[model samples]
Each structure stands twice: as C-alpha cells, then as structure tokens.
Target: MTGSLWRRALAEALGTGLLVTVVVGSGIAAAELSPGDTGLQLLENAFATALGLAVLILMLGPVSGAHFNPVVSAVDCWFGQRHGGGLAVRDLAAYVPAQVLGAIAGAVLANLMFGEQAVSWSTSDRSAGHLWIGETVATAGLILLIFSLARSGRSAAAPAAVGAYIGAAYWFTSSTSFANPAVTIGRAFSDTFAGIAPGSVPGFVVFQVIGAVVGAVLVLVLYPTAGDAADEVVVPHTESGVTS
Candidate 1:
C-alpha cells in the first residue's frame, strides 16, 4: 500500500477496534449491571454503542471514511467507481483486512478488560430465518440511509443519523442490527452479551451482502446521480485532506 493508503488503513483499524471495544465492553457492563433484565441490558448496550459510533465517525470519518464495515467499504467502492472517485480495488483490499483485524483485536481487548477469557467463541446461536430477514432489512436500511445522505448533500448529518439508525435497528430488528460483517465476525469471538455464535456469522454476512446490493439498487433508483456523491457517503475525505 502507498503511504496515504497506509495511514487510511491504520485509521480504519484503530477506529474499528475502538468501536468493537465499546460494543463488547458496554455489553459486559450492561449484563453485569442489569443481571437478569435483558431489556435493561440491551438498552445500556444500545445507548453506549450509538454514542460511541457517532463519536468514532466524527473523529475518523475524515480519514478512511470511518468505514469500519466491509459492506460499507465494498458498497462505497462500487458506487465510487461510477465517478472514478471512490475507493479503488486496492484500497478495498487494504481496508477490509484492517477493519477485520481491528474488530478482532477490539473484541479481545473488551474481553480482557472485563476479566473474561479472550477468544472465547460465543455460544449464542442466532440462526433463524426471521433473524436472517432482520439482518437483511437492517443492512439495507443502513446502506440506503448513508448513501442517501450523501446524494442529498446531507453528509454532515451522517454521524448522528447513522448512529441513531443503528440504535433504533437494535430494537426493531430481530438480529439487533449487526449490519456490519466485520463487527459480526468480531463479536463471534466473545461469549458475552454482544457475541454471536461462530456458526451464525456466515449467514449474517450473506444476508448483509444481499441487503447491500438491494440498498445500492435503491440508491440508483432514487438518486440517479448518486454516483457523483459516492465520495461523500459516511463522510467526505480526500487522500491528503483532513476529511472523514
């Protein structure tokens, strides 16, 4: 990777790592604090994740577009190609691995911080047709929302809007909106409140991809010039500029 790509990849790794840390750590804390109250536990986890995600986007969106999710990165690449202004295939290669690695590290760090064993494969089996449907819906909505904001020149609201959307999806979707493949894989490593069973990761990822495709279609239909706004999704940034 080039020097600029390296920096962007590092930002992606660090931002994604920290995002997972907040997710897993808050989940552990929520479970411990709420004990048997699943509702309260979820509330706590959702609140923390929403706020943390917003902050992460604001902080790193200028760098690497804060695309901590592979689905998002892939979609950005696809849309960006239309205008020759989004991430290149090589950037995608660098970004996916970095995001995945960061997510794993974040999960491990959260586990250790909570005095739990690192790398514990989760036992939470989330396999179900309904849950799969939920994943698709969640992901599709996420993709539509982010890209729509860009197309409408409303990228400035992405931080709070994306965060709020995920937070809401957690309650509305049976799958709790694990719309991110990297996050899904990372959460598989922790047998905690936020974890998903390893066996479930593949299904979630597949549905997420399907949802992304659906969402991209929606963007094209709704905003024919959406490709022109490709570099604006999630946030705006350039190779040498402080934009995210």
Candidate 2:
C-alpha cells in the first residue's frame, strides 16, 4: 500500500518469475543429473525448490508481499476488502496478471537454460481423481498455513515454513503439490520433468481454487480474527518499511 502500484506489480512479476525459474530449472537439472532414478530426481528437485522459495520470499517479501500466486492474491483481496485492510481489488488485478506472466517467462527461461524448446507444450497428463484430490489438499494446507501464521503473529516464519511445507508436500502429495495456479500454468509450457500437460491444467487449477475457498472458510471459522492480520500474511511489507 505504501509503494506505487507499478513497483509492487514489478516485484510480484520478478518474484514469481524467479520462483518458476527455480522450479523448472531444478527439475530439468534433476532429470539430467539423476537419469532413471525417480526418487533421486525428486529429492533434488524438492530440495532446490524449497531453498529457492525461502530465499525468494526473504528477498522480495517486502515488495508486493511476494505473493507469486493468484490464489494468495485473491484471498488477500477478499479478506482485505472485507476486513478493511489487505490487497485492494486493483492490486489483485495487477498482481494476478503479473504473477501469471512472470510464471510463463520463468518457464521459458528454464527451458532455454536447459537447452529445451522455448515453447514446447508438455505431454505429461495428470488427470486422475487422486491427483485432483492431492491438489486440493496441498492448496488448502498452504492457505491454512499462510493465514494461520498471520493470525498468530508468526509471519516471520513464513519464509522457511512455506518452503518446508512445499518441499514436504512434493513428496506427500500425489500431484507433487502444484499448489499454485500460476506455477501450474507455467509448468505446462515445458515438457520437462516438472511439466504438466496442457489438458491437465484446468482440473488442477479448479481444484486449487476449491482448496483455497475451503481453506479460507476454515480460517474464518477457526480464527475469527484472522482477517485482521491479512496485511501481514506471507510477510509484512510496505514501501516505508518491512517487518518479518
């Protein structure tokens, strides 16, 4: 709220771009480095993603709140508007587009880095019902964790906590926890180890949205005052200063 809208949007773009870059790039690296070893590849990919996400949050959380995901931005907008403080509708408008575009750019960058086609559509189909359930659970857990931190004055732990959760979710969730819509869309642009087929995107996104709604509702029910901390979710950020 303290910075120009453009600046915040720019931050979101850059943060999300970097996040996807880490994910896709690491996946590619894992495949190349650990060929035929699915477990090893996943381990490497999950580790890099976890560390990269935490670092990115710490680096950019003070700007744009480092949302890097449409669901997070939407939740912020909803709670912010309803509770008197959070991302405004205009901010959501800019942030979501920026995040999506950034995600695409990140995927392209990763492909180029790995000597893959710049725009190869993925063929990895993930249409099983279990996968959809995984997405829903992953996304819901993410939302619950984020909002809970804000409500509990534990926003400072988000950088590490979020990263750890995603890393763990990668192994626990059947869908590898593509819990973010932007990231899911971006991954579709590459046919690498991390990519998902274009046809599979809608289902994942829909479930993710459902998960977000469920999570938000749960937060409101469990912590009636959670919205009061909407401005602090992920990390407290402002043009003037930052906390946590």
Candidate 3:
C-alpha cells in the first residue's frame, strides 16, 4: 500500500477514536454529574468534545484530510480527490468501521465512567423535522468552516474551529447539531448520554449530507481554483485544479 494510504488510515482511526472518546466521555460526565438538568449536562460536556475534535483534526487532517466522517469522505470522492467506489464496499475499509467502532467505544467508556445512556434528540425516531433541520444547519457551518481553513492553509487551526462550531451548535441548533452523518448514525447504537435513538439515525444523516452539499457547492462557486484569493484552504487536489 502507498504511504499516503497508510497514513490516511492511521489518521482516520486514531483521530476518530480520540474524537469519539472525548464526545462520549464528556457527555457521560455531564449526565452523571449534572443529572436533572439536560441543558447543564450538554453545556458542561460541550467543551471537551470540541477541544478533542480540534486536536484530532490538527493531528490527522494533513494525513487523511481528517475526514473523520463518511460524509466528508464521500464528498471528497465526489469532487474527485478521494478514490470512489461502491459506498457499501468502500466504507468497510477504514471510514465506516473506524467511525462506528470509535463511537461505540466512546459510548461504552461514557457508560462505564459517567453512566450516560442516551442522547437527547429533537424527537423520537429521528423523524426528519427538527433533527433534519438542526443537522443541516450544523453541517453547513462545519463544512464551510472546513473549506475556509483547508484553502487558507490554516489547516492547523481547523480542529479548533470545528470544535467551537460543534460545541456552540449544541445550544444553537436543535438536535444538538450532530453535523456528521457517521456520528449521528453511530450515536444511535449507544444508550449513553450522547446516544441518539437507533431508529432516528437516518434522518439526521440525510440532513447532514444535504448541508455538506450546500457548503461544498458554495466552495466551488467561490473558489473554482487553488490560488484564488477567495479560497482559504489549499487542499492537495486544488493545487493543480485551478488558481482562482
């Protein structure tokens, strides 16, 4: 395998593992420690989840573009940067399993340490109203934020920005702003404080995908190249794609 591929895989696994762990762990801490007040629980745990995501993105982005989420990866593939294949087949490699396992591990850890068992959703079954809207808003913000950082070559700060967006999104967006489809779906399996109900995962993911598409479209329209003054990120694919 190419070194790039290995690096990407490692980044995906390690970065996602740490990210999920923080999300699940801190959420649990909030639930068990805060208890009665849902708002307090979410508020207290938001920081660590954000910080952890920030750190992981900084560590893994240059390696694997720090996709961490399948939606990010899928979009990359769609735009011709990532190697595309059957969604079901390709996801098995590193993207899907890693994310799922990471989420599960995070949930288990949260349960063991903090005793959280479920994430608060806008509604039961994730039926696409509030959750879909929240996911879209949150994801659009996240992808746009990513585009800004990646193009500007300020990739190092991407994680922190992402973390801040997500942390703030908790209070700002309904459905706790589960912007990443992979994360939204995976969280369903858990019964911990961070868990979304198993049945509701699909709607959250669909909305996230829609939001990311919107964000990416805006990026394409604005930049259309690498050296464009309009673009803040300098992702590898954009180097030869164009120059503003």
Candidate 4:
C-alpha cells in the first residue's frame, strides 16, 4: 500500500461514486426501456452492473485496492494486519467514510440525472425475513468469492469473477443482491426501481454484517493455511512506481 492515503481515499470515493451511479442510473434506464417486463429490466440492470464493476476494478486497482464496499475493506484490514501486508486500521477508518459519502453523492447524481428530486427518500419497502436472508446469502457469497481469490493468488480474475458472481446473485437471490452496505445506503436516496426504503436499511445492513462474519469464518474453515497476504479487492500494480 505505497500509495498516499489521500490518493487511495480519493480513488475509493471516486470508484464507489461511479459504481453507484452505474447501478442506480442503469436501474432507472432499464425500467424505462423495458416497461412491464420485470425480467428484461433485471437483465439489463445486471449486465450493466457487472460490466461497470469489472471496468472500475481494473481501472482503480492500483490506486486504492478499489475497495468500494465497507465489508471488503474491513476484511482486508483484518487479514492484512494479521499477515503484515494489508490495509492498516487507519486506512480502514479512512476508506469506509469515503466510500459511504461517495455512495450518497452518486445516488444524488443519479436522481438528478433522471430528472428527479435529489434527495427523495425511497418508498420501496424491502423489509421481510426472506429478503433479509437473501441479502445475507448474497453478501456472504460475495465475501467468500473475493477472499478466496485472494487466498489462492487468483486476484487477477476478480474483475470478471466478481462481476459474474454478482450478475448471477441478482437472479438467484430474492432481494436482487444488494450485497454492499455502502450501495444499500446510497440506494435509499433514490425512489426508483433500485432504491431501498430508508426504514429497511438497518436490517439489511445488520444482515450484511452478519454475512461478512459468516464469510470470514468460512474462509478460515475452508482454507485453513491460506496465506494472510490475501489479495486486495483490486489487484495492485507498480508499473509506474505507484502501488496500493
């Protein structure tokens, strides 16, 4: 993590902001383009998200490890501290806030772009036991995929693998796979097809956190001797004397 903290944080913020922009904006566009066809709309939205996430990760991997999600950052920090080559606690502190703020800004930007109020709280009530379970499963699987890649030194595949996984999870999980906490909060600002009601956020976040814990435990159990130097969410590079 040789990149300056400010630089890394900026990359996280920008990357996350753009990620949310793609998500909410695409959802809006999908709904508009595919009117009554829920399946088509989902397909459209999922494709956009998968492609966009892959590109973002590739673009920002060297800058901040592209940890747009808080759970990823936390897990990275925990692993890095134990193995001596991951994010520091201070880095985690900086990354989470940046990711959250960027996510909010992205949502607002999406709303404004779609000709809606900037801060319209969503009315979509996604509060149900089944939905919570879906979120938990979605998030847990995401963590497992990411950390497992790190453990196996296959981080280069993350862009495609992660993208593909999320695309699949969107359909497999009932809650449409809002596996990211930052993204969850961001969605609360939009009252569109992708938005989640503010009231339902807490439960979703709690479940996601539980899912993260479950994923970490699974990692330990499944890969008992996995290296501590698990790959960052984004693969770092040093081609021009810059690193993350």
Candidate 5:
C-alpha cells in the first residue's frame, strides 16, 4: 500500500511536470523559434498538449488514476468515477500543488532556457471572448468524452480521446481550450508565452468550475450508475482502485 501510494503521488508529480513542460516550456520555445507569430505558438501548444495528456494518462492511470487535471479529479467525484467521500480532498491536495509547482518550474526553465521575458495577459478582445466560449465547450466536450469512454469500460482509451479532442478543439474552438483549471492557475504564475495574467485566472477558473459542474450533470443524465462505468472486475479492496 505504501509503495502504491508513493507511486501514485510520484506519477502525479511527474505527469504534472510533463504537462507544464509542454505548456509553458513549448510556448517559450515557440516564441523564440518564431517571433510575433503567435499563430504558430497556438499550433505548437495544441500538439504538445495532446502529446502530454496521452503520455501522462498511460503512464499514471494505474496508480494515481492519471488525473493530471484538478477539474478532472473534481468531476470524477460527481461521476462516481472517483470515490466521493474523501478521495476528492486527497486528490485535489496532491494534484493542485503538484501542478502549480510544475508550471512554475516549467516557466523558470523556459525563461532561463529561452530568454523569454515576462509578458502581460494575451488579450481581452474578441479572441479572448472566443476563448471563453471555447473553454466552456471544450471542457464540456472533454468531460462528456471521459464519461462515455468510462461508461463503456474503455477507460483505457480516455487519454487519447481527450488528447485528440483537446488538440482539435484548439483549432475549432474560439478559446484555445484551456480546459484544466489547475493548468490555468499555474499558467497565471508565469508571465511567459502561455501565461494568462493573474487577473484573467479567476474568471477562467469560474468558467471552468461551471463547465465541470455541467459535465457532472451530464454524466448523471447519461450513465447514472457505477456499474455503467465498469464491468464487474474483482478489485483488491478499494472503490475505484483507490484506498481511503
């Protein structure tokens, strides 16, 4: 049990670190690779995010349940995918700090490695407005995909599905699909290429929470049962492969 838990935490930390590296690290890289060509930055981010999520899920699903996003961990509670009573608290505690630190670390490396300066918030214009809508829909779509995949006992496919959706949504949606709140919060701490000003973080988080709640409600409307999520496989001794 001890070893399993350490692995879980380690997986989360490593997963988050990789995510940050992709988000902030690649953003800085993009900025350096092509100055004033933010379009290329977005493109790079989309692909990197997809790759990051896919790798994280496969690498950590067996242990930490591969919840690289705090919002994912939160809504998983509502879907009954994650054990509700106390599991939420513990996962949140671990994921939030891990992600925050990872983002900062990524940002630090980006600055030192790329010589990118701290920049202000991207923009609050139409693009940002579009981004808001994109955020809402992207988050909704992501949760729905997870709910459906889990309901079908195909949770193994979830990482790729989510990664693909997020990557594609980056192109279709008006918002660049900042679907994960923890990532948003962490991004704010860094005024790097991917950074959203501290001012923008709160509004993004609010929308993210609302989107997650909506996702949870949709899960109830669709799956409605724990068994709907998985086959009757024998487990060692915990609900949802996690212990209290």
Candidate 6:
C-alpha cells in the first residue's frame, strides 16, 4: 500500500499481461501439439498455467501483491479498510483498469505470436446456466483460498497454493475455471483455444463478482478477528515498505 501508485499499477499491468499471455499462448500450443486428444490438451494447458501463475506471483507479489484479478484487488481493499492496512480506493481504481487493459494486450500478443489476426473476437460461446454456476464456484473458491491464507498467516504459501487450486479447478469445474475476470475478458480477444466469446463475457463477470461477495462473506464467518491482524510486507516498493 505504500508503493507509488504508478509502480504498483505497472506491476499489476505487466503481471496480468504475462498471465494472460501464458494462458492463451499455452492453450494455442496445446491445441496444436495435441491435435486429437482433448484431455491431453487440457492437461498441458493447465500445467502451463499453474506453473506460470506461481512464478508470476513470486516475481510480482512483492511489487503489487500480484493481484492480477480485479476481484482480488477489490477484496484486498475492503479488507485493508476494515483492518486498517490494505490498498487505497484510488489504488484499486488504477489497478482494475490496468489489469483489464493488460489482459487485452496479452490476448492480442498471444494471437499475434500464434500467427493469428490480432484483436480477433472469439467465437467460443460459453453461455449456459451450468457454466455460470461453475464460474461462481471457481471464483468463490479462489477468493476463499487467498483470504484464508492471509487470515491464517500463511500467505507465503500463496504461490503454490493458488496455482495448485486453479489447476485442480480447471478439471473439477465444468467451465474450465475462468476464475479471474480480467483473464476472462482477455480471452475474449482471442479466437483460439482459450478464448471466450464476447457475448458470454458479461454473465461470467457478473457471476465472478457474485462469487467474490460470497467468498468475502465466508471469510467474515470463518475468520472473525479479535483485533486487526498485522499486515505482512509481501510486496515491497523502493520508497514505501508496505505490501498489499
């Protein structure tokens, strides 16, 4: 929270952009490499994403808490306000927009790398009640995992824990666990393996927000604090030693 807003925003943007690049790029590679085997392709994609996410978090968590997801930023801000050591509202404002723009750029980057047209809208329609439910569940679980780690003083385990959870959720959830809204929107710009149709983006985002609320409520129920927990300095900036 003490870092300059510009530096934190840059970290969020770069981290989110790289995250989406890994997702869409891996998906495209997997599809190409494992032509007829859908299961194999999924496995490959999931593995890449898990590994990539873990590394990104480790690299950028010190810079911006590596909150590549808007819901995570929002939740962190809410917790900061309630507990007296979290992201400022203005920071949240900057972070979300940066993440969204980063995601779009990442998608376009992936498409161009894969020899596809840049900025092509996806045609992969994912609209369905069941899919929405799956997204909700996936996102909710993600939020729960993150806040639970913070509450339990186990945030150091976040890189592995979060990566592992998303890998599992990819298979466990029917919608392939597009848990992060920024990533979901980014995928809309690609028409390849990991893309989500533009039309389906809204429903998915709404459900993810609902899921975030559910997760926050769960945190309140599960970890009622006796007093403010000391904020950990996970992300460090040059001027401000505060972490998100």
The candidate maximizing lDDT is 1
lDDT of 3 by residue, 16-49 (tens): 6666667767776787788899878888878778
Question: What is the per-residue lDDT of model 5 for residues 53-122, given as tens digits with 9 covering 90 to 100?
Answer: 7877766565566666677766654444444332345555665677566655555555555655543343
Question: What RMSD does each model have against the real structure?
Answer: 1.1, 1.5, 5.8, 2.1, 4.6, 2.5
lDDT minimum window of 10 residues, candidate 5:
230-239
Q: Cα deviation of 7 in candidate 5 (Å)?
A: 3.5
- Model 4 Cα lDDT, one tens digit per residue, 1-244: 4357877888889989999999999999999999999999999999999999999988987777777999988877877777776787888898899999999999999999999899899999999999999999999999889888877888889899988998899999989998889999999999998999999999999999988889888888887644365545556543242553
Ranking 2 against 5 by TM-score, winner: 2
Where does candidate 6 have its weakest 10-residue lDDT segment? 226-235
Cα misplacement distance, residue 85 of candidate 6 (Å): 1.6
Give the alpha carbon lDDT tens digit for every residue of 1-244 in model 6.
Answer: 3447788898889999999999999999999999999999999999999999999988888777888999988887887788786777888899999999999999999999999999989999999999999999999999888877877778788889889999999999989999889999999999988999999999999999999889878878898750143243222223242453
lDDT of 2 by residue, 1-244 (tens): 3357888888888889899999999999999999999999999999999999999999989876778889988998898888998898988888999999999999999999989989899999999999999999999999999999999999999999999999999999999999999999999999999999999999999999999999899889988888899888679988543554
- Candidate 6 lDDT: 0.85
Which candidate has the highest TM-score of all? 1
What's model 1's lDDT at 114? 93
What lDDT does the true structure give each of the candidates?
0.93, 0.91, 0.64, 0.86, 0.65, 0.85
By lDDT, the better pick of 1 and 5 is: 1
Better of 4 and 5 by lDDT: 4
Give lDDT for model 1.
Answer: 0.93
TM-score of each: 0.98, 0.97, 0.78, 0.94, 0.79, 0.93
- Model 1, range 71-138, lDDT digits (tens) per residue? 99998999888888778999999999999999999999999999999889999999999999999999
Q: Which stretches of candidate 2 lie over 4 Å from their true place?
A: 1-3, 240-244
Q: Candidate 6, clashing residue pairs? A: 62-235
Instruction: Mark the regions of model 5 whose C-alpha exceeds 4 Å error after superposition.
Output: 1-3, 81-88, 116-130, 226-244
